[model samples]
Target: MKKPIILFVASIFLLFNKVYAQDKFTLEQCVSYALEHNLNIKQAKYTQAISEVNYSQSKLNLAPTVNANISQYNNFGRSVNQVTYAYSNNTTNNLNYGAGANWEIFGGLQRLNQLKQTKFTLMADQTYVEKIKQDVSLNVVNQFLLTMFGEEQVNNLTNQLKVSQEQLAIAKKKADVGTITEADYLQFKAQVANDETNLTSAQNQLEIASLELKQLLNLEPQQTFGIIRPSDAAMVEASKSAYEAVYVYNEALKINPSIKVAEYQSLASERAVSVAKGAFYPSLNLSANVGSYYSWNYYLPVDPANPNGPDYRPTFKDQYNTFLGKSINLSLNIPIFNGLQSRNSVKKAKISYENTKASEVLAKNQLNKTIAQSVADLKAAEKKYASAQISFESLKKAYEFSQKRFDVGLINSLDLNIAKTNYSKAESEALQAKYDMVFKSKVIDYYLGKPLTL
Candidate 1:
């Protein structure tokens, strides 16, 4: 019984460790994983692939179309024989085989223009995929930073709770000895309880933040996850950097996928207009056909002396060879008026092209506006973080002094608790400002087409 109990306990311990073990990832690894596994990115890539196929098919359309057909027919009751070109009273079987090819020599360059349009469309979709990747990477960065911030908050609160518990222990001893009043002792007890509640809340928030990051990564909920934290110095250094909106916008326009997507779409729409206009010009097509047929009822002409004798049907190969025909024809189609369809198509295409051009301009303008706003926000965040740091340091020193005075009976529990509260608020604000600054800096880096790190 004892041995069985020991084995069961050992198994439980191993299971606990397995369940709680964390899978740690750096920022680069998280982004890489999301890119590979994110459903949005996968869907975008699928669209890109479809565009590639369309482009390939458009290129293939420039080639001629070829088709082959074969038919067998049985006729009765004085039907006309196709091979003999005569009426046959007897039941007969006829077989036919043919192959034909048609090549468009010119259709006002419609096919060529369509090919160009699909090529441009394909390029646009490819760029769109890259744009989606950038978007996903930014989202990952946001969630990752939030999770890190939450962890810091939890840590800060936990330390505060420990300090409060220590003070409560001293207060309890002093109260029992009649050195501290009941109200003062109760204040210390309340402070400890308050800290405990705040710490619990912070831990819950950290869990929520981690959960969001895990969802973004498409990880299983049961899977423990952790991030590799960057150094404080690195984050502070990054926050100090400055960016000019004009410079960042210029850099963004050079590599921004969204702008490229719009530009390509505009080019594709322009080609569409050309394709539609091509319908107004005459089209030329060249077609070639080869065919032969044999009929079972077909017979050689009767001999004059043996008219009533047995009739001889021609052999299949002989008839096929003798009846084989080949023809090639060139056809020109002048586009006569047809309910103004061609004209209407051209007009619609032009309208669509104009819309695309407008969209391209809109994309550029939006990018510029966003860059300017991001630069301003980053500057503000830096200032906020700097001020928060100073405030946190001052309150921290004041809190330590209050604690020393309280221990020596120079101050009461309320004074010490107030100082602690102020310090906690400043610490929380500092953490918020620091992470906010870091995130804003990363946004600027994104516009500059730099790899997201830390």
Candidate 2:
């Protein structure tokens, strides 16, 4: 029996160890995982790849092209041949084989312009993906901090409940000794009930927060995760200026992914104008080819008896020859007129370029506005947090004094309960303000291209 008990205990210990061994996701880990698996990041990467391919194709367009061709023809019955003037009634065959190369020495630098535009576009695409990553990281950070706050609030509420229980026990003892009135005991009981209700609400909030975090992680409903809380009394030290020191507005205009993409668009549009202008200039090419040909014919006259020596006896012929040569030819293509197509294309491209320029300007303006607003909100959250911290500190001291007074019978249960309730409210509000500050700060960092890490 002792051996069986030992085995069972060992098995239980091993199972607990296994459960704890599951990997824990830090903020960095979460962000990295999301970057690797997120749908938006994947799509952005694909778009970048397409841009790279387009750019490569533009460069390849300048390279030479080689081609080969073979053709054969047979003619029968009374035909005068080029090499020999004779009426042929049998059959004649001709075969030709050739190889050629065509290369454009120049296209008015259109290929160069296209390649440059594509490169810029690819860079923009890369930045855009980074921007999406920053956004996803921000979301993860917010949800992680929010979940932490909820957990802390729940713990605070639990502590408050414990204090209430202690006070209720003291009240019962005092009432039994005739030191406290029944009304005082009843008040303590009411306080305990209120604390219990608050605890339940906090628990519900924690559950919701957990579910939300799980959703963001794309995890199973039953999965359990943990978040690292910021260091103790962070609210006390988190000042307004320090929290808003992130260079969001300037970076948003300079480094924002959307802004970068807009700039790339403007470059691409400018290249389009160059491409249109290229049509006005001449194009040059160097080309070459090599091949061999063979032909065979057997002929009989149509007028047999009256004409050529008893219908020219059927003749069997065979010939084989091979020749190879190479030549370099420089060709120039000049565009004289195309019904003003090139001119109209240039006009359209110029218009599109202007539109892209305007869009880039708009993007910068919007980015600035977003950053400014986020900064303002962060500053406001800092102020609110400071006030909440002060309120919490005062209420905590008051609660302690009230408890001491009640212990000495200098304060009624009703007054002590009031102090406890006030302290709880202050703590909740402080936690809320602290979390709000964290959320807003993350948004600012995201815009600034400085996403939070572990």
Candidate 3:
């Protein structure tokens, strides 16, 4: 009884797992998963984090530096006392403590400019991370659509195979009743075999597409995966929406992370030039210090009134108060000569600034070109899909008419096969055109900063 119960429990568990594995995923879910698991996005985020730290440190650099020090000294040989400048033969012990602070009052605004440069650098890095995410999302979209197309092909072929098998069954019956020739009946059998082959090929293609999508999502090979297919109406509706190249370019320029990254980098380079130029200017600093010390071997003279009074050393508190000293200083350093390092730095910075400015222009030009091409492709795909749809519908009606004529012995097997072949070709072409149109529309949406769906 116990063994039977355990077996039943195990079977139930396996069934549950199978059901869970077969669950379908929507496009949004796939995109979200890729975003979280993609290695490139993770690396980009790490770089952005480093930029954040640098930005923080640059701001902190403007603050003053404070330090404290302490030391102990023991002298065993004769030495001159620091306090009395007298020779001493006995052992002497001394302790010292001090604290000081230095503040940069001026440095040609170098610190300020450095802060600004880091801020812009951080912004650029942040935008770069977003750019990586956008790249990953687009990749996911492309793969997802490809997998969907494969599924549609498989489904269409499966339906065709069913219809061929049904016709073959009818042909066999007619042949047995001596109403159809053996060649005609055999032709129906051949049609069914060919459709079976096509269906198998489509299924294999679908499996390959699914595997590629799984790799993109970083999923285990053994994992069972399926996609939530969008309805035909949804796809048609999405394709109907149109975008102009100029409008898409204008919108993309405003929100595209790649373009923003270049602009921010340019700003950072400009600030870096200012920071380098600051090295040629004079600098001012302020400092403050306070210190005190004690000696163990030194003592005060004996009291005259009490002639036998023991010689006494000053108390620690008293010594500390008596020996304490404080000082403040202000210094100015004028830049004169240093191997012309500052001049060279400023020159390099200017050149870098120019490079970044050129890069900014290049990025904008590329974006414009891409937007124009995408819009053109989308229009072409729309026209192709429309033409394919009409062709498929016409072929479908012709094939139906020919099949009916063949059923009544009015048409030959060859004529029926020709009509069927034409219809099948049209069907495949229509499916291809439909997916192409959808993908191109999605590309336009991506440039316009719209969310990708279906």
Candidate 4:
């Protein structure tokens, strides 16, 4: 009874393990996980946060500044009473405290320009973060799709293994009954060995695909999971026009995060030029403060109109006073030449502005080039997929014929093997073409601003 119970428990555990091991994973879940945990996306988010702080600083720069200060000084030296306040015999003490606020009235629009430039910079940084997100999503989609295709291949190989095993059994039975030659039975045996090898190879490829998908999702490499095919089959219809996708991509260039960033940078550069030119203009600031001070003194005299025998007296009195005052001061500064520093600044700023414009143009040109290349690739993949369809169909027919002939001894193992190889090659090529077309379609959709969906 103990042995039977132990065996039952072991079987139950094995059943549960199999169920757990075979749990399915979908593409959307994988992508979501990656977005949350991927290192590159996290880094991009940090960069955007830094840009936000910089922008806040730029805004705060325009606000008024207030400061308070207090100081007390004591001096003891040779005293002089009627001349300089400098201590002669002197014990002198002074105390002062004040509060002031300074608000910029004008600075040739320099502060405004600085604010504008930083705002544009912040926009650029944010766009860069979005671009990183889009890139990560694209990568995740590709890997996820590849894993699906790999699963399909593994299934196909398993079916082929089953067919080979069945054929080997038939050949073995015929040999036992002396109806088939030893050489023919040997051929079937060899075919079974090849099929088993192929099955092992397929398993290995499946593991590799699973690992790659897990890596993209930032999951542990040892994890095993199935991927559900999320998207439709590759588009078999050719594009209506070669320029259609290109036009869409061109539109995307207008809004593509990188291009937008470059545009913002150009504006920032223009603002920079204005800031630099501010050196030629003057600035004004207003400041005011209200405060109070107090003082107390005690002295002893040996002979100072003295009554009471060199009188010692505590004549210190508590005196307090408070007053409110206001002042508006105007400062005028005319620009004086300082080694042509202002002129050099303006020149450098103008050069930088020009460079920014050049970069903007370069960015646009690169965008156009990228679009053109992607369109070409899309077309090529479309054509390849069509060719692969034809090749795969023809190879399948040849394989079917070769299989029948080998069973009847009309074809040798070598011929059958060649046919099988051709079929496998054609099938793989067709699958690759299918995936390529899907990937290109995604690129087109991305350029067209289409949202990716399950």
The lDDT leader among the candidates is: 1
Please write out the lDDT profile of model 1 over residues 1-454, one tens digit for every residue. Answer: 8999999999999898776557588889999999998888989999999999999999999999999989999887888878667786878888998899999999999999999999999999999999999999999999999989998999989888998888889889999999999999999999999999998888988888888778777888778789999898987796678789999999999999999999999999999999999999999999999999888867775585877776788898988898899999999999899999999999999999999999999999999999999999999999999899999999999999998898798999899899999999999999999999999999999999999997
Q: Write the per-residue lDDT of candidate 2 for residues 103-146, one digit (tens) a residue.
A: 88898888888788788778888888887777777878877777
Q: State the local distance difference test value for candidate 1.
A: 0.92
The predictions' CA RMSDs to the true structure, in order, are 5.0, 7.7, 5.1, 7.0
Q: Number of the top candidate by TM-score?
A: 1
Q: What is the lDDT of residue 267 in candidate 3?
A: 100
For every model in order, what is the number of clashing pairs?
0, 3, 0, 6
CA deviation > 4 Å runs, candidate 4: 1-25, 71-96, 165-212, 222-225, 231-243, 290-329
List model 3 lDDT by residue over 230-316, tens digit each: 888977787777788999999999999999999999999999999999999999999999999888865775795875778888888
Which ranges in model 2 have alpha carbons more than 4 Å from their true place? 1-21, 69-98, 161-223, 233-256, 291-332, 336-340, 397-421, 442-451
State in Å the error of residue 324, model 2: 7.5
Weakest lDDT window of 10 consecutive positions for candidate 1:
295-304
lDDT of 4 by residue, 84-109 (tens): 33445656554445677888888888
How do all models score by TM-score?
Answer: 0.89, 0.71, 0.80, 0.78
